[model samples]
Target: MHEWALVEGVIATAARFAEENGITEVTEVVVVVGELQQVEHEVLEFAFENLKTPLFKNARFVLESQPARFKCRNCGNEWGFTSEGMTEDVSEAIHFVPEMAHVYIKCSECGSPDFEVAEGRGVWLATIKGVKGDE
Candidate 1:
């Protein structure tokens, strides 16, 4: 799954950063996952669990949700994503299947796909604070 690769990349990045900073222990990790990216929370958590010991056994995965932001194609007004608000209207689209629950966000104003994906398109690390001990 792409999520695995993404998660592993994040872990590796964090590990490399910690290593470069001469930090041996990672206390906590906070990350923000955008909704438009459509990452599975359970799988992300499981991936984190499997790699917990390899990096820092006590390191924790903190997943924060970044709501989907839709821009208005007509009036340029933007709105946050909601299940019944934006996704339900596109149920007929194959990408918005009920089983997989995947549906691209459409502009609420002009109903156009010309708008940009601003908020919900990336996984960001919020913070990684810890003490670097000398080995």
Candidate 2:
């Protein structure tokens, strides 16, 4: 799925940055995922595990998820995603979509589907903590 590509890309980018900074021992990595992005944190971590070697095995991957939010196009009302936001819980609900079902983000105030993402809509590697010393 696209998640694999996405995760790979993230890791590659981070690895490059780490290398450039001469980060030999990464202690922690934090990633943020917006609800609308629909990325499975576990899957992302699993991918990270595959890439982890003796050096990075001790690295910690922390996932921070933000609730999906939307602003009503008509009433200017904003709302957060709730359990009601998902129509079904797939094996990996964060990454799976029903074949015939379309995901809708309806405005809580106007009961309209016209809305813009107000929050929980993107993926970002927030930080990478490492130490640099005598080389």
Candidate 3:
């Protein structure tokens, strides 16, 4: 699954950051996942569990899932949608290719197809708690 790739990227980035900063004891890695990105938490955790190395052996991987939000281009209206709102076909499309979300998401107030994502669009590294050698 793509979650494997996602976890790999996260580990790579965190490792690079730790090395650059001389961090020796990484206690936690907090990741914020966007709903629109459709990141499966179980898969992401499984990937981390399988791939983490000694540098992060003691680090806890924390995933914070967030809702997808959109703003209308026409009326400045913002809204969010759940998969239940979609037709079976639309849901299937989004499940396989999340990019298709735009085809189904519409502004609730203005019914505009044109809109921008206000939040919950992608994966982000939120916090890394670690020790940088001595105080």
Candidate 4:
């Protein structure tokens, strides 16, 4: 899965930076993930467990999931795509094809499917916390 690649990149980048900065122990790797990415948290954790032994044996991965947001192309209305109240069937359907969001989720202002994603699209390495070799 792409999460593996993402985790690997995050670890490699952070590890390089940590070594350059004299960090001996990477304590945590915080990833900011948008819902549109559909990154599985457990899978990310698994990847981290498998991929971190080299430079970050004691490191822990943390994911901060952000909500999806959209802006109506017609009416310029912006709103969060709340999935907490969605039915299981609908959730599964959308989970299968997230692009169907524009088809199923309409603009609240003008009831239009034409819209743009205001947020929730990619993953970012928010921070890498570590301790120095002396500390």
Candidate 5:
């Protein structure tokens, strides 16, 4: 699953951060996931469990979801996105490439496809807690 790839990237980034910061032992990592990615939490958790490096051996992986929000350029109307009414194919398309939102979604107020993804686009390494070497 793509979750595995995502977790690998997260671990690599976190490990790099820990090394750069002289963190000897990582204890926690907070990851923020955007809703538009449509990532499966269970799969992500499993991937994290299987793919973590020695630096993250004891790290508690915390996941948070960020809701998708859009702002209309046409009318300056802002709104949240929900997949409730989308077909599986449409949802899958957006899941793989969130930029497709512009193709499939319209502004709630102005009914214009021209809009901006105000938030909730990709994964982020929100925070990392660890013991510094000199601590």
Candidate 6:
């Protein structure tokens, strides 16, 4: 599943960061998930449990959700994104390709398709905690 791929990238990035920073034992990793991505937390957590390497054997993987926010270019209106009224297919499409939001979403104020995703678009490795080599 895509969650596996995403976890793989996260583990790799965290490992590289630990190596570069001389962190001998990773303690915790905080991953930020954008609402637009619609990542399944259970699947992601399972992937992390299965995909992490020795460097992260003791690492605690934490996932946080970032609410999607948008800004209307036409009316200058800003609002949050919600899938409440969206069809399953449309929601799934946006989940796989966030940019597709432009095709399916519009400004709640002006009904204009021209809007910007002001926040919550992609995955991010927000924080990493570990024991340095010297420690």
- Candidate 3 residue spans exceeding 4 A from truth: 85-98
State the lDDT at 51 in candidate 4.
Answer: 84
Model 5 agreement with the true structure over 69-102: per-residue lDDT tens digits: 9999999999998998999989989887888899
Candidate 4 per-residue lDDT, tens place, 5-66, comes to: 88898888898889899998888889998786667899889988988855688887899998
User: After superposing candidate 1, which stretches have Cα over 4 Å from the reference?
Assistant: 82-104
Against the hidden reference, what TM-scores do the models get?
0.74, 0.73, 0.84, 0.73, 0.91, 0.92
Report the error of model 2 at residue 67, Å. 1.6
lDDT of each: 0.67, 0.67, 0.82, 0.81, 0.90, 0.91
- Cα error of candidate 1 at position 14, Å: 0.3
What is every candidate's alpha-carbon RMSD to the true fold?
A: 4.9, 3.9, 2.4, 3.8, 1.7, 1.6
Model 2, CA-based lDDT: 0.67
Candidate 3 lDDT, tens digit per residue, 1-135?
A: 168888898899999999999998788999997787676788888899999978888899999988888888899988885877668777767655666777887778977788988887778889898988775
The ten-residue window of minimal lDDT in model 2 covers 94-103
Ranking by lDDT: 6, 5, 3, 4, 2, 1
Give per-residue CA lDDT, model 1, range 18-55, as digits (tens): 88998888888888877755667898889888766555
For model 5, the local distance difference test gives 0.90
- 2 or 5, which is superior by TM-score? 5
Off by over 4 Å in 5: none
Number of the top TM-score candidate: 6
User: What value of lDDT does candidate 3 attain over all alpha carbons?
Assistant: 0.82
